[model samples]
Each structure stands twice: as C-alpha cells, then as structure tokens.
Target: MWNPLDSITVRTFLILIGGTMLSGALVFTLAGTERKNLESHLRTHHAAERIEQAIQLLDSAPQASRQAIAQVYANYGLRVDLAPTVGVVGQAPDSEITQELRQQLGSDRPIEIVDQENKDCPAFTGPHPEDKPHCISVFTALKDGTRIKLDVARHDHPPPPFRGNFMRDLITFMAGLAVFAWIVALMTTRPLRQLARAANALGSNLKHPPLAETPGPREVREASIAFNRMQASIQSYIQERTFMLSAIAHDLQTPLTRLRLRLEKVSDPALRTALVADLTVTQSLVREGLDYAHTITTDEPFELVDIDSLTEALCNDAIDAGSEITFDGTSNTTIWGSPLALRRCISNLMDNAVKYGQFAHVSVQKSAGKALISVIDGGEGIPAHDLEKVFQPFHRLEDSRSRESGGTGLGLTIARIIAERHQGRIILKNMGVAELGLVAVLELPLAPSN
Candidate 1:
C-alpha cells in the first residue's frame, strides 16, 4: 500500500525518519567519546592481568615444566615463550600501553619493553582471525636464568576502503528522500492549483459553481466552503439591488410622461425651455441608473469577439456622429466575453473622451497574453486627488466637465464593472506633455488557447 512516488507522503515520512536517524546518530557520536575511554581501560586491564598470570606461572614452574606451561597458555590464544635475552631492546615507547604494563608488572619485577623497530621482536598473533603487524611485547628474566616474552596485540587494521556497502546505503537514502520530496510537492500543489483555477474563474462568472469539498485536509476544505459562501452572498446582493432599481425606474416612467405632457401646455417659452432641460437631465440620470443596475445583474454567456474589428467599428460610429475619434492602432486577436457588454464598456470610454477632450484616440494591443484597450483624450486631465472619486456612482468633478454638461458619472463605474466581469480592470493616468490629456486603459484577460 506504500506509494514511493507520492510526493507528499514521501516527504512527510522522510522528514520524520530523517530527524529520527539524525537524533540517533548524534547520540551515538556523543557517547562514542565516553565509550572509547572505557574500552581503553578494559583493554589495558585485561592485557595486564593476562601478562601477570603468565609471568607468575613461568617464574614458579621448574625449567622442565616451563614449555608445557607456555603450550597450555597458547591454547587459550596467548603465546608465551622462554627465549634468550640477546639483543633485547631496552626502553619502552612513552605510551599508555607501556605505562600500564609497567605499573601492573611492578618496579620490583621490571621487564624489558620491546622497541617497535627491533627486527628480532616477536611476530605477535592476536585472537582475531586477521593479522596485525604492530603490537607491544614485554620480556622478563626468570630466577632460573631464563627469560620469557609476553606479547599483547590489538586489532587495528582500518575497515576495508569505503566503496562497498556504505556507498550503496548512502545512494538508497538519497533516492528515498528525493522520492519523498516529489510526492509531497504533488500532494500540496495539486489542491492549490485547483483553488487558483476556481479563484480565477470567479471574477468572470458569478454563476460559476461552488468548489466541491475534496478529500483533503480540513483547512483546505474550510477555505473552499468559505469562498463559496462569499461568492453566493455577493451574487445575492447584486440581484436584490438590481430588482429594486428596475422597479423604481419602471414606476417613475408614468409620472415623467405626465409631467412632460403638463409642461407642453405652458406658454412661457424661456421658462418652459429651462424646465424641460432640467426634466430631461433627471430622466437621463434615472435611465442610466437603471442601466447601471442591469449591467451588474445581467449574466450573459461569453462568446468569441474580435477586439480589433470591434474597436474599429466603434471608431467609425463616433466619426459618423461628427466626433474626432480616430483608431490609433489595433492588435490581431479575439476575446471571450459578452460582446454587448465589452462594446458598451469601450463605447462609454470613447464617449467620455470626446465629451471632454473634443477628440478620442483608441488603440488595442496585446502584452503578456492580455489585451489592452486604451482610450486617450486631450481634455484638461482630472486633478490627481479627484481621479478615484470620479468613479463613484453619480460623482462628478465641479469643473467645466461638470454634471450639467450631461454625464451620469456612472459611465466610469459601469465601464469598471464590465471590465471586472471579464476578469480584467481599468486604470486612469494623466498623459505626458504638460499633463493636458488623460489616458483610460482597459485591461482584459485573453481566453485560453485550446
């Protein structure tokens, strides 16, 4: 049931196992220093005891029985010999092995310590199966005029060079860690990718379905549920507001008509003209208000729309209406959105430009897989402080471009809403050169290519 390829599980297990291994290794290393000291004491103590026993037996036994005694000790893996003391190396090496042997052997029974370079030194054999070239040997003269040699050897051959089982185990651990990391990455990233896709789709499609609760951690499930509820709340609020505005607009229509009929009967031409203008302005505001509400509530199906041709046609329409609206440039691409909504968003911007600048320049370009449509105008650019304020519904700057000049102020607001519904946004900036113009940029995300 174990999947080595599953990245999340593998990573989790490796981190768990690696931390355990590291802790174990650290403890072993720390204890190794103490262990070494105990091992040295035991070695020296054991060797000194064995040599003392050999010395006692040889010294107490008769000359004829010495060989028999040595042979008996040899059976226990210790070699003892009664050899002549000719060319005996005198001084011992200044090391713990020498010092321990001397202290245990005692000053009264001082023995000859074998020098390492002495060619005649005994070829010592140890209890281990492997052979060792280095060891310590002691020599003592017996009371009967014969000398005996005692040898103690330790296993000191370095473990065979590192290319055997060690390399294989190291490679195995690294492979396991890599697999664990891979598995962990896939586990976390897959769910996160799903969340990202859902988030991206939400901006363009309010009716997009809620994210399904997946078989994952509780945190991820909770986050998905929260996102769904938030989306539903926003959609509900928009629908309710739109219904209220539409009802109000429909109710006011009859009253507006009766007022128009009554005003038509007035005989004062100048006064009637002023009243009619005011009434017309009110009617325009109310109509635009209803339109704004509809824009938010309307959920049109997205369709393929050619951006270049759309901008060119809008330019022509403005030109026909006796406006200096020119197509500066265009890109070759198609977008996916409500064609009516996108056209209206761009048209509103163009109308705004001409109303203030007396001219409008439109262009379309693609960058980083997104389409950018810019509406530039030669109007006295908005004050830096009032730029954002102008986007509020029914908000207007009190300059020559005032509300009296026939603007609902919902133009920018509606344009912003449409842009956002297409998963894009709009930004306004003052044009270069004396800041005499304003540039309204609409950025729209392009449809994914199949």
Candidate 2:
C-alpha cells in the first residue's frame, strides 16, 4: 500500500529527471542527423576533387613511375586503378554526385560517378552498396593525350562510435541532472510547509495574521489568499450571529418576566404551579440559546490556568447542586485556555452524566501532549446510532423526553462547540467494558504553561 512514487518529492524528482533525459536525447538525435548531412556533402565534393587530381597527376608522371604514384594515393583512402573502357555503354551525363562535384570542380569535361556511388544521401540509405565498393571511373584525356580509366574506391566515413570518454560524459550529465531534480523538489516543498503552518496557527488563534499574497508560486499564493478570505468570512459570520442573538435575547426576556409575574397572581394553586413551571422551562431554553451563541462568538483571550483546580471547583459545585459526582483522576497540570469556557464545558458534561445516569464519575489525564477529561456514568447506554445525534442542538434522546427530566437539549451542543473553539474535540461513546453507561471524552491540545 505504501509506494515511493506516492511521495511528492519522489514524483517530482522522477518527472524532472525523465523529462531532462527525453529532451536531451531528442536534441542530440536531431543535431547528429544534421551534422552527418553536412559532413557527407563536403565529403562527396572533396572525394570528387581528389579522385580527378590524382588521376591527372599519375598520368603525367613518367611511364615507369606512374605505378608508384598510384600506390601512394591508394594508401590515402583513394584506390586508383586503370580500366580499359573510356566510357560507359549508355547512362545519364550528370548524375546527382556529378552535378554536385562539377559545381565545385568547375570543369566542363563530362563527369560520371562509378555507379553514381560517391553521392550525398542520408546515412540510412548509402550512396554505395555494402560488400562492393563504388568504383569511380573518371574517363578523361591526360595532357599527354593518353586515354585511361581510373577506378577509385574510397571507404565510407563512419562517425566515431560510442565508447570510452563519450560514455563517461553522457553518464555524468545524467547524474548531474538527477541531483538538480532533487534540488528542485526540495525548493518546491517549503512553500507547502509555510502554508500548513499558517493554517494551523489560524485554527488555534483566529486573530492570526493573513498570509502574504505573493510569497510563493502562483498556486500556493492563490491558496493562501483563499484561506485568508475564508478566515475573514468566518469571523464576520460569528460577529453577525452574536449581534442577532443579543437582540433576540433582549426582546424575549422582558415578555417572559411579565408573563412570570402575571402567572404568580393566578387564583388556583395547581394552575399557577404548572404555569410557572412551564415559564421556567422556557426561560432555561432561552438562556441555553444565549450560551450556545456565546460559545461561537466569545473573544476570550487564553491564559495559563491550573486545570486540576478548575475541574475540582466544577466538581465541588456539582456536588452542592445535589448531583452525585466524584472526581476519579488527577491531571496535576497547567494549560493555556479560557478559564470560564473550560469550566462551562466540564460542568455540562458532569450535568449530563448525573442527570441521565443518577451519578457521575470524572477523570483527567495528560497523554501525548494532550489533556483528556472523561465524564462517565452508570445507566442504560444510548443506542450506537444515537450517540452522535445527541450532540446536535435541540436533539433529545427518546428516553429523556419527559418534561420532568428538565433538559433544554443544548448542553452537549454547547460543550462540543466550546471544545472546538479551544482547538479540541469532544466525542460521546457507550462505555461498555464493565457497565452499561456512556462516556463523554473531551481532548484538548496541551499548551505550554508559560
């Protein structure tokens, strides 16, 4: 399941190296073809000149020395021999090789190649066939009026083959390219690291500065700009929601107070008791709404707090409220957080456990640079499917629907929101190992006490 190519660095390195090799090969191949073309053109014209000159020089020599003169030219890749014929039986006057050679030679004398062999053509298709050398028969009259055929054969010039230092140079270039690709991969990764750090800082503190719009490549710069815009949108949304909730709370509280006073004047004791109870429940729901909104909009700055003592005070307060709650573990730690929000989060957890299960057990500990607090209770555990749904605002479980149970159904929602606001997570699960119960675990990032 793990693949090296899945890594960004490996992928980038491989792509760069492959592209460099392919491009280099393409360039070298094209250049080699053109170079061979030009070399063959020059070789054809030069061979024509040398063949003609060698024939004339040899013919002008003394009759006894002509043979030695021919041997000297033959050793220099030009083989000269005498043929009996002064002309071919029938053929074109100017072949492709002759036309090109005549242009350089500037001789009006009829010129013909041996089977048209010394012509310029692509390397794949040669001017001469293998196993038989192209014998150039230059039929010309010497200055002494002697007619003879000079049969000349020159070996095809081949380019230097790949070997020795040629191979070493090619291999060195490839190795250097691979190193360059790795450096490019490293250069590309730093921008991503900066982006990640900025995002994490934004999550921990909403007031984090925006990322520079032009700090990296185009894609990274655009992503950072989008992140900054999204953060601003979220901040604005929270402010707008808090203002709306403030107006609603103020408008609704005055009517509820008047209704409570009016109900106190009812003649029948049973009727007044029931009405006042309903009014109190409505008030509790309104207060819970305000609490949830505050969780979203609170601008509380974090401070160093003794978490152990904070949770201790919450447990003591729950006991005073006639809840059967016990603190079962010690965190013995200090953390950076808003003291009021953390206390509210823990108090909600304890209230849920004690109200639903008749008793609450609380524990806290430090694990892997995180502070974890778990509130557990002994009761008929919620069904597996309903564990997460209970955290939704105004969503109550079927068993706790009676008015006498007295919940505004926003306790768990507010607690989870507060945890997230502090860069933490809250999860509810059935605690089934030893008893039929549930546990609400809140895990918060551990901050330095300083």
Candidate 3:
C-alpha cells in the first residue's frame, strides 16, 4: 500500500530529471544537425579547391605526363581522369559543387556539372550493382585547347570518423544532470518538508512554536511567514473562544448556586425536588461546557506515559468505588502524551460504559504500531446511524438516554479531543447482532523507542 513516489521529494526529483533529459536530447539533436551541415559545406568547398589544383597541375604538365599525374590525385579522394570528347553529357552550372568550382577555376574556362549516371565509370561495368558508386562529373577545357573530364565519387569522401563512444558520453551527461537535479529537488523541498512538520505539530499542539523565518528564496520565505501568521491567528482564535466560555461559566455559577439555596427552602416537597433536579442538570451542562472548551485549548505539555499502568490504576480506583468494572490485557506500551489528559480520556470512556451499560470491560494491546485500548459495555448498542453523532457535545440518545442518566453528554466529546491531541482516535461500533453491547476502541500511536 506504500509507494516511494508518493513522497513529494521523489516526484519532484523524477520530474526534474525527466524534463532535463528531454531538453538535453532536443538540444543535442539540433547541435548535431548543425555540425553535420557545417562539415558538409566545408567538405564541398575543399573538394572544389582540390579539383582546381588538379586542373592547373595537368594544364602545366607535359602531355605525356598528364595521365600519370591524374592517377596520383585519385588516391587522395579526388578521382581525376583525362578524356577526349567528354564521355558523359553535363547539366547547367547551377549546382552548389559546380558554383564552387567556378569560383576556384575562373569563369573564362567552360565547366558543366554532370547530373545523371555516367556509363564511363569503372564501377558501372562491375558485375554487382552495390559496387556502383554515386559519381559527379565535370566537363571543362584545358589551357592548351585540350578537353578534360573530372569525376568525383561518393566513396572518395567518407564521413568523419566518430571521435568517441557517443552512448557513453550521453550517459555521462545524463548522470551529471541527474545529480544536479537531485540536489535541486532536495533544496526545493527542504523548506516545504519543514513547513509540513510544523503544520502537523500545529494540529496536536496549538502552542507549537512558529516556523522560523529562515533566509532562502523569496517564495519559500514568504510561505514560511504566511504559515506562521496562520498559526498565530488560530491560537488567538482558540484563546478568545476559551476565554468566552470560561467567562460565561463563571457568570452562571453564582446565580445557579443562589437558585439551589432558594429551592431548598420551597414549601412543596415534590415541586421542590423537581426544581432542584432541573437546576442540577443546568449546572452540570455549564460545567461540562467549560470542560469541553478547556480540552480544546489546553496547553498541556507531553510526557512519556505508561498506558497499561494508567488503565490499571483507573480500573482499581473504579473497583474501590464499587463500580462493576474490570481491566484486562497489557501492551507494556509507553507513549508521548499529557498524562493528565490521557487519564481524563480513558476515565471518561470507562465512566460512560459504567453509567450507561452498568458495567465496563477494559483492555489494552499493541497493533500495527499503535496501542489499542478497547472499553466495551454490556448494554443495548446504539443505532448505527448515531454512532458518530455520540461524540458531538450535548448529543444524547432519545429513548432510554436522558439528562439524568447520561449526565452532561460531553464525555465522548472531551475524550475525542484528548485522543486527537495525542495524534490518536477513538472509534465506536456496536458489538454486532448476536452480542448486544457497545464497543469503544481507542487507537493511539506508539511512542518511538530511543
């Protein structure tokens, strides 16, 4: 289920490498094409100069030595031959090779480039068709009124030899690019990774320190500044909300206490009992409301807490108080969390089970890098649809659950807040059709060992 490419750094590195390699290949191709074109142009002009020099040499040589001199030039990729009556007919002097020859050999002497195949070539008479070479013939006049034909074959000018292994050089280039891309990916994602860590910590601890305004690129610095500002804003909002709730609870306490005193002095005993009960419910709501707000904004520092020990102590305390509760299972697990907060969380769950189901069964074990604490109650399970809604503050079941039975209804709400602050969660589910009970599973991440 896990993938390395799911990481932002890996994806960024791959994207940089792919994009750079593609761009390099494109540039390399264009450069290679340009180099080939330049080499071809130089070769053409060089071949023309060789032909002009050969002509001058033959023109000045004695007639008897001209044939021998022509044969010597053929060994150097410029095949020269002397012919009478021009063995091959030629085309107009408009081609590139022909124009270069005119520049070197002067316009005074006639010159025509042969465009078609020439039967007079030696390879043309060979038995195999592959032996025949592409030939370019030029017909021109010598200085002494002698006619000569010059032949240049494709084989005479071979392509330049490769200087080195092309593939090896290309691989080396890509490796260098990959190293550079990886460095860039790391540099680019470093700040983002830090920001992500800070954001995650913010979820569990609103008082988490703000991100440092480290010096870097403008965009990264700006993002850091923005994230810090957002963190500060959230902390401020939570503080304001906690203050408002505390103020309201403080104001309600005095009047509620005075009302309780006044109700005790009432004449009608039945009416007074009902009125006092209503006042007690109102007082519990106000107290639990404040407790819920405190859980949200608590600046409780984390410490290593032994989960098994904590649950065992709570179970023993409940047994001492005459509650039908039992604790089982041991994970020997220690986690980084607020001890008091975790105690509050586990106590609330056990209290709910005891109060609603009349009994509580608690257990603890380790699973998949988490410490799972399960508290099951032997009571009619809640409807499937309302399982999640029970965690909402002041939310209670309609039929058998009432203010007198369920208390303030903020137990689960407070418990869930504590679980989430410890980077854990509590899941509620029925015990299934055959087993008529409610199961509460508290899953918390295990503390990393030193």
Candidate 4:
C-alpha cells in the first residue's frame, strides 16, 4: 500500500500539527485555571457583602418578627434561621471567604463560620446539572442575644459548556494548521524537485539550458547555482575530449595516405599486397574513430524523418554492395531526429550484423507508440553474459569474432550514443540455443502529433 507519509510534505504537515496542538493544550489548561480562580474570588466577595446586609436586617428587627424576615431572605438562594444560642459545632478554617466575611462584619461580637460537609440546602436549587449540593453556616449573636444562623449554599458561575462549538473550533484549528503547513512544505521542496529533474535530463541532454536562478530561499538558490556550475563543467569536459579525438584522426589521414602509396611501390607483389592491406586497416580505424567523435558532438538540428524509408535505403545500399542482406516489413513511422545521425546509427547496426554474422535481415514495425527497427544476423549468437558488454567502447568477444573481420570495436557504442540522443534505445539479445543469431532492436519514440 502506498503511504502519504512517505512524502516529505505530509510528514512536515503532521509534525506541525502535533507540536501546535501540544502547545495549545498547555496554554488552554493554564488559562482555564486562572479564569476559574478569578470567578471564585469575585463570587466570595459578593457573598460577603450580602451576608453583612442580612445580619444588619436581623439586628434591627423586633425579636418575634426577626424569624419572619430571615425566612423572606431564604427564597433568594440563601437559607436563614433564628435560634436562642450558637447551635453549630466545629471550628472554621481561615480561608478567603471567612476572612472577607470577618472584615465586612465587625469583630466586636462573637461570630462563627462552619463548613457543613455532606449536607444539602433544600430551600435553594442550583441551575447546572454538574453542580453539587453543599452548605456553609455562619453563627453569630444578635444585639438582644438572639442567635442567628445564615446558610450559604455553594453556587458558582462556571464558564459556558462547549457543546457543539468544541468540535467546530477543534476542526477549524486543525484545518488552518494543515493549510499553513502544506504551504510551507511545498515552498521548501519545490526547488529540490526542480534540481532533481534537471540532473536527470543532464545525462541525455548536456547542452540543455541551465536552470534559472530565480528568487527563493538562500539554500534553494545556492543549490541551483551549484547544479548549473556542475553541468557547465561536464559539458566542457565532453567538448574537449571530442575535439582532441577529431584532431588526432584528422592529423593521421595525410600520413596514412602517404604510407599506402609508399607500400604500393614495394618490389615483391606479395609483400606489397600485404603492406597495403595493413595500411588500409589502419586508415579504416582512423576514419571510424573520427566518425565516433563526430557522433558524440554533432550540432545537428532535429526534424521529422520517416524511419521506414531510412531503413529501406540502408538495406538496399547494403544489397548493392554484394552483401547477403534482406529487407522486410514497413512501419510508416515518423520521428523527430537528426537525419544524418539516425542514418549513421542504423548503418552501424546493419554493418555490424553483416560483418560478424555474414548475413543480415532488416525489418521495421511500430509497436506501443514506438518504432522498432530489428536487425537479425545469421551467425552464431553471442553468450548472454557479453550482450551488454559489446556496447562498451573497444569491447569485443575475441573467442567468437576475429579481428580480421575489420572492426575498431566502436560500432555499437556509436550506435547507442545516437539512439540515446534522439530519446531512443537499442537492445541486444541472443536468439537462444534453437536460433543461431543475435537480434538488435532499435526502439525510437514516435514524433508528436500535429
């Protein structure tokens, strides 16, 4: 199964989300605690003031009517009652609410505040489902010595519940983070992708234009500059090598011609014939070396060429030269390529097949959007191990092929170079044990439609 996390962009986005969410969680927790503390402080301050007002009301009222006034205050979420003496047990802890109450109501008279645990205030009701029932009692003596008990139930104004808004806000946060992370990842990786594409094309097209050093991050711009420099270096090296080979081949021609003439003047006919043959072989090697160098650095422009016609012309020329060769089939396929380069490539394949195998069968056909020109020979096929090795410069199987057959061992090498220049390839394969020949298939992509 394909994984999205395999891509750098997805991984970066996920990492941003994880870190942001973790940081947000810590911030929300701390903020929530501070907010709850503030609300509790405000509620305690307001409760203290109300308790002070209620005590004053009981102190000024007639003794018999004081209970009636206390009962009237019970309806507003506070419980109140009257007694003859202090009725509560247990001491109250010194807390914020107790201190605030003592400060608001003077310390002249005896006053007691007791927290009643595991007790419910039946006279008052709470508004929230999560609210627990609890009560606090404050006992103090009135001016007439009548004891008054004030019960304050636990009431709090909690922050509103999240309900559906929690999910909506959560989704919004993640979606926003994802978009921002995606943009960041894409910006970081685009130049790297462009550099990779240029590197791959450099193998097939060294003379291709250099990458643009567009404005971007410092690291990406630096990478582009480095890549362009490397390309220029490689192109300069290939040009220098090609020029050196061409120069050597051109310089040897005059000496080779003079040697051929001098060998013809030998007194003995057999000796002269042998000397001339040697000179001819040396000239052929020089000429093929020059041709191979030309193939490497040709500046020919591409145009549409009919592959079938080119194959027929080469095959017919070989036949006219008294070589045992046959032409079969037609593809009517056209390709965009240099006509001279394509000719040299196909001629090398035909010459190799006929020279080594003694007879050659050439055919052309279109398959799978590519034009295939196959040349099969009549000679014994080469071993499977040496099939790819033959394409290397100056590589030959000496056991099966003799040097006398006249090859500088650069035919297949030159052919493959031209094929690759035109975005095509040549494959070599043995015909197996049953068939005693080698097959060379030149596969070229078809030209684009009009």
Candidate 5:
C-alpha cells in the first residue's frame, strides 16, 4: 500500500521549510550586521583619544617624563617620534630654544598646538610613515625649541571574523530547522495517513465496518463523524428497500396464483393457454425482482478461500450440464469474501456465455490491488449501447426474446448487485473477435488481511 506520509504532496513540505528558512535568514543577517558596525565605531573613537593624550604628555615632560609618556603610549597602542631643533651660532643664538623655535614656526600656515606655553612647539606634518597613511597628525611645540610630533593613525582594526562565524551559525540554525521540519511533518502526516488507510478500506468493502471516530483537531473529527453517518445511512436504506420489495413480491404471488387457477376453468382452449402464458411471465418477473432486491440487502461474510477452487467448481458445473467450459490461472491464490455470492456471480456470467455463445472460458488474474475474473465466449456480441442497458432489470436484447432463450432479464442485474455488495464491479463488452463474442469482466479489490 502507498502510505499517505510517503506520498505527502510537495506543496505542504515546501510551505513548512520555506517559511522557517526565510525568517531565520532575515533575523540572523540584520543582527550580525549591527553587531559588526557597533564594534567598528567603538574601536575608532577610543584610538583617536589615546593618541592625542600621549602627544600632550610628551611635549610637557622632562627626559624622565618622556619615558613615562612612551610607556603610556605603548599601553594605548600609539607610536610617537620626536626631533630637536638646530640653528646657526648667535644669528638666532643657536640655543635649543632658537633652533626648536625656528623649526616650530618654520611652516607658512599657522599650526594649532595643545600646550604651546609650557612645552616646546612642534610643527604638524601629514602623518608618520608607519601609521595609517591617511591619519591626521598632531604636533606640539615646547619652550626650548624641542618639537614633539604625535601621529594619531586612523583605527583600521580588521573586523572580527564575521563571515566564518556567521556561516557556522547559519549551518547550525539550518540543522535545527531541518530537525524541526521533520518533527512537524511527523505530527501532521500521521493523522492524515490513518485517515487515508481508513478510506481505502471503506472503498474496498462497505460491509467491513465503518471507521471509528478519530480523535484530533476539529477538521479530522468532523470528517470522521460525517463518514460514519453516511455509511450507516446507506446500510439502513438498502435494508429498508430490500424488506419492502420482499413483502410486495410475497403479496403479489397469491393473486397471480388465484388468477392462474381461474383461467384454467375457461372453455376456449386458445384463450386459456394465452392467459396462462401471460401469468407465467408475470410470475417469473416478480420472482426475479425479489431475487435482485435480496441481492441488494445481502452483505458478504468475508473468509479466506482459494480462488481457483471457486472457478473450478463453476467450470465443472457447466461441463456437467454438457456445456464446454474451461478454467485458467493460478490455483493457489486466495481472497476474502462470501464464497456462495462470488460463485453465483461467476456462474451467472458463465451461464450467459454458454446460453448465447455455446461455450464459456473462465480466467483469473491478479494485479496491483485487485483481482480480475473474466468469462469469454464465442457468439454475437452485444451492441455497445445495449451493454449497460442489459444490466437493468427486465431489459432484453431486441432479437433474443424467444421462449427458448428463457430469461426473466434479471440475470445480469442480480450478478451486478452481488458484485457490488462485495465492493466489486462487473463490465460487459465485445471481445473484438472477428467471430464476435461477449467478455464479462469482474473486478474485486484484494483483501488486505489476506
């Protein structure tokens, strides 16, 4: 059997997985980008402040203070370089102050110094070669013309390894989503699978007892209730109709019998004979109608039986009656159903073939989830349009209503009712032989328990 879970439609699975993946991607991407941006901002602002403080300390201190300031700069990840001033003797006095002062004031543009009064002034340059090339440089000038230059390099700390970490996190999230998807599939599919099995069983045989009411969400419960009610209604209706038909057939028989007795006393032989013939035909029809009605109410009591045994019995009976009959197919195959009803259905087809076609050939085959029982014959085939009509009660072929043919026109109808009771069907059609013949095909669902 094809399981409902195994055959879950593609649309359902796509909806589940697609929704989860899209939501996860959106949240992960936005949060990861924000975290990276904030870290970048903090590193840049802190680096700028540390570099400025180191430059101020270097300009104000003595040689000892310079060493202390350098230590502080190392701690804060800053680099500083200083150069003293030089000048010609007595022209500008050639003192440290004159040389340093000349260098500090050498630039044409006005230099902004943080502590010009207490420290030697240093002229600002672009930036130190070792620092970031585009950094802003700060210079301080001192009293003795010693210049202190501080290079505040732009902060360019490589971003934390976001790509690699994000990929790992994404993989983990996807893995969790996959597990969650399967879990949801199991929960949702399990109930539907059960319902499918129940439907298949019911289709195969309505007499197999209606499915029990399933407990679950509202939709499933409602469906179960409706199916059960429908099954009960159908069963009750068939039983009621069958009972009414039986009563009618029984009540009509007495009046028909009395009329036949009264016609026997008629003095005119031809009139008496014609009246009796009409009564006989009417009585046969009543009996056949009751038989068809009974078939509708009959429920097959299923039991495992060898299919070959049933076919052999039908064939043997036909042969003993001097009809050419044959059975073909596997002998070991077994199926579940009412043996008497199934045998009768097969026998009825064989009888029709032999009556109209002079011989009967029976065969059985199994495929997929069904069993086929076929009866073939060699005779004039029924017309295409009349094929379905023949299964209706009292219907007869236009040319075959002679007394010798001897049928109440209910044979096919009864057989059909029996097949339907077993959750099977009967079909009649031409076998396409040039010597034209009828082929009756009976299809029955394979019993699951068997």
Candidate 6:
C-alpha cells in the first residue's frame, strides 16, 4: 500500500504539470497570430512600390518601343506585353489603349490625361499562371499622336524561411519550459515529502518532534505552520487523556477497597454471598482501570522475544486452567517489545474468548514487517454495530450479565491500547460455524533485535 504522504505528493505533481501546459499553450497561440500579421503587411508594401516605378519608365519611352520597355520591366523581375493600335482602314485605332486615349483627346481643349485604362497587365503576375497578380495599367498619347499603354505587374515574394525557423524556436522554448516546470516541482515537493514522513513517524511515536518549518513560497510556509500546530495538538490530547485516566483510577481505589471490606461483614448467608459477588465485581473493575492507567504511564524498555514461544506459553496456561484452549500455526518468529506488556495484551484476548465463548484458539503469523495474532472462538458473536463499542472501557453486552460470563469489559480496550503503544492495531471480526463466534485479531509491527 502506498503511504498517504506519497499519495499527496503525486497529486501535487499532477497539478503542476497541468498548470504549466495550459499557460504554455496560451503563449504559443498569441505568438503565432502576431507573426502572420506582420508577414502580410510586408507583402502589401512590396507590391505598391513596384507599380510606382513602372509608370516613370513609360513616360520617357516611345509608343512602339516594345523591346526597350519589356527589358526595363524584366530587369525588375516583371513581364510585359504590348500591341500597337491601327487607325480606321488602318486609320481607326484597333487597340484598347488607343481608343481610350482618343476619347480623352476629343474632350474640350487638349486635356491633361491621367492614365485610366483598365487592362489585364501580365508584367506584375508571377511565372505561375494561376497566380494572377494585381498591377497598375496606364494609357497616354505620346507627342507623336501614337497611343501607348504601360503595364506593370509585381510578383509577390513568399515570406522568408524565418517564419519556419520561428516556429521551431517556439517549440524548443516550450520544451525548455516543460523541463523547468518539472525541476521546480521536484524542488518544492522535496520538503513536502520530508514533512509527510515526519507526520507518519509522529503518529507512531508521540515523543518525536515535528519537521522544521523552512522558508519557501507562501503555500509551502502555510502548510508547514498548519502541520506544526497539528503535531502539538495530537501530543497535547494524548497527554491529557493519560492524566485524566490516572486521576480517576487513583481516586476510586480507596472507595472500592472499603466497599469490599464491608461486604465481608453481611450476616445472612445468601444475601452476604450476593453482596460479596457484587463487591468482587466492583473491585475487579477498579483494578482493571488502574492497570489501564498504568499501561499508559509506564515507559518500559523493550527487548527482543520469540513471539511463537510467548504465544505458546499463554495458550498453555489457558489449557491448564481447564479451558478448551489450543495453539495453532508455527511459532518460531521473534519480535521486539516489552514482553510483560505484550503478554498482558495476548492474555486479555484469550481470557475474553474463554469467558464469553467457552474456548480459545490462538494462531500467530508473520507478514510484511508485522506479527498477526488471532484468537478465535465458537460462541455468540458480537453484533456488527456493537463490535466497535465493545472496545470502549466499561462497555458490556446485555446478554452476558453473570459474573462468570461477562468480565469488566476492559480486556479488549486494554489490548488495543497495548497494541497501539507498539505501533500496532486490534480488530474484531465475527467467525464461527454460523458466524456466531468472535475473532479478535492483533497486528503488531515486527521489531528488530537490538
């Protein structure tokens, strides 16, 4: 199973990746649009300049000077075609430019004619026939009365390879951005991983201090502050609970002793017997309470012990007591813990099984750095709802009211506390012929020998 801390770190990394991709995409889109606009403006300006230069050459040339004019147009990487006009009976002008020029010439007085003839000028068009370019066409009557048309077409140049180079550069930039994002995430997440490991250790051992709150970005600093507060709160709560249990146990012992003494003085045999039994029950409860309180207060040094041997001894004692108890499974593994405390926890579980279920069957198993000990029995199982409640101190089942049947009800609670003190856990499950018996499972970490 992945640790909860590792899960948090993975989630944080994914968020960083997602945010970086979104921002990079937006920047790439804006840059591409701006480059296209600038390229289009440059093409338009080049076309306008070509038309102005062609008009100046036409004004200084003769009307029939096709070769000279075509040469000038070709020098500028343009194409030109011209045909002379023949008048009526070779006297009326046949060319489009000559007819338009005659119409302008007949206007009142010799009018200053602005060339206005519209013709398909081939000079401005490119070598590709399909790429029909726009050009300036001018018609004018020269001093000899011969009409001339100047056609100038400019070929549009494709934008240079820089646009493709720019695209490549942008791609490279985005790749670098992605790499930087990963590096940043790795650096930031390192501290978070340390904090998480510390928190997990703290859960298992309250004596350990929290991770230091190092300086970083706002989010990281805030998380560190919150974690520090949580650590202190957990320690405070555990200390308070320990103190409260101790005080309660200490204050109640005197009254319980006095009551037991008074029960011995009753006169009627039957009534006295009943009183004695009640007093005994009260004394047992008080003693169990004191034991639980002590369990929390005593910080006994731990030592390595063979868990199999420990469990076998516990089971053998129950069998000798006339209880139908047996130990099952191999018992050669070793674990580190306070032997006295571990024995108490296992014995409590076995006692509960015998008291409530009539027999106890114990088993021990080792897996994944933990030792699992289970006590199984065949009797009335606990209700699903009340299974958890039975672990609370002083809780008891309504059906098991007899002194011989129901114990002080602190056995399971104490066992759980002991297991937790060793960074372990206890679980209760229903198991029997008809699921009518109880199975108490204790999971304790495997401690290494010192």
How far is each candidate from the true structure, as Cα RMSD in Å?
A: 7.6, 6.1, 3.7, 4.5, 10.4, 7.9
1-450, model 2: which lDDT tens digit per residue? 899986787888888988888998899899889888777677666667786687657656886787787678655555454434434443343355677556654575555555435332112224443444444556655555555555555445567657569888988888888889999987887677677888887775566788888765788878888888998997788678777976797678899999999999999999999999999988888888888877766768888878778888899888898888999677777778899999989999998888888899898898878888989988777899988888898898778644577787889988987787778989888878665498999998877752
Candidate 4, residues 50-87, lDDT tens digits: the string is 77888888888877787788777887767777763446
Off by over 4 Å in 3: 1-11, 76-79, 89-94, 115-132, 156-163, 380-385
Predictions in order: lDDT = 0.77, 0.75, 0.83, 0.82, 0.68, 0.70
TM-score of each: 0.70, 0.72, 0.87, 0.77, 0.67, 0.72
- The residue pairs found clashing in candidate 2 are none
Name the candidate that leads on lDDT: 3
Top-TM-score structure, candidate number: 3
Kindly indicate the candidate among 2 and 5 with the higher lDDT: 2
Where does candidate 1 stray beyond 4 Å? 1-149, 155-172, 189-200, 385-389, 434-436, 447-450
- Looking at candidate 4, what is the lDDT of residue 382? 81
Against the true structure, candidate 4 reaches a TM-score of 0.77
| Model 1 accuracy (lDDT, Cα) | 0.77
* Candidate 6 lDDT over residue span 301-396, tens digit each: 888878889999888887888888988886457777889999999999998988888888899988777888999987788889998999898788
lDDT of 1 by residue, 1-450 (tens): 966756554566667567756875788667765677676667667767888778877878888898898887766545676885454444564476666766766666657666443333334455444343444567776766576776555344333335468779867876886676656656766777777788888776667788898778988989888888988998798778788988898788889989988998889999899888888887888888887988877888889888989989989988998999889676687889999999889998998998887788899999888889999998888888888887888888888457568887888999998998888899998887563489999998887751
Clashes of 6: 8
What TM-score does model 1 achieve against the real structure? 0.70
Q: Between candidates 4 and 5, name the one with more favorable TM-score.
A: 4
- Deviation (Å) of 27 in candidate 4: 4.3
Of 1 and 6, the candidate ranking higher by TM-score: 6
Candidate 3 yields a Cα-based lDDT of 0.83
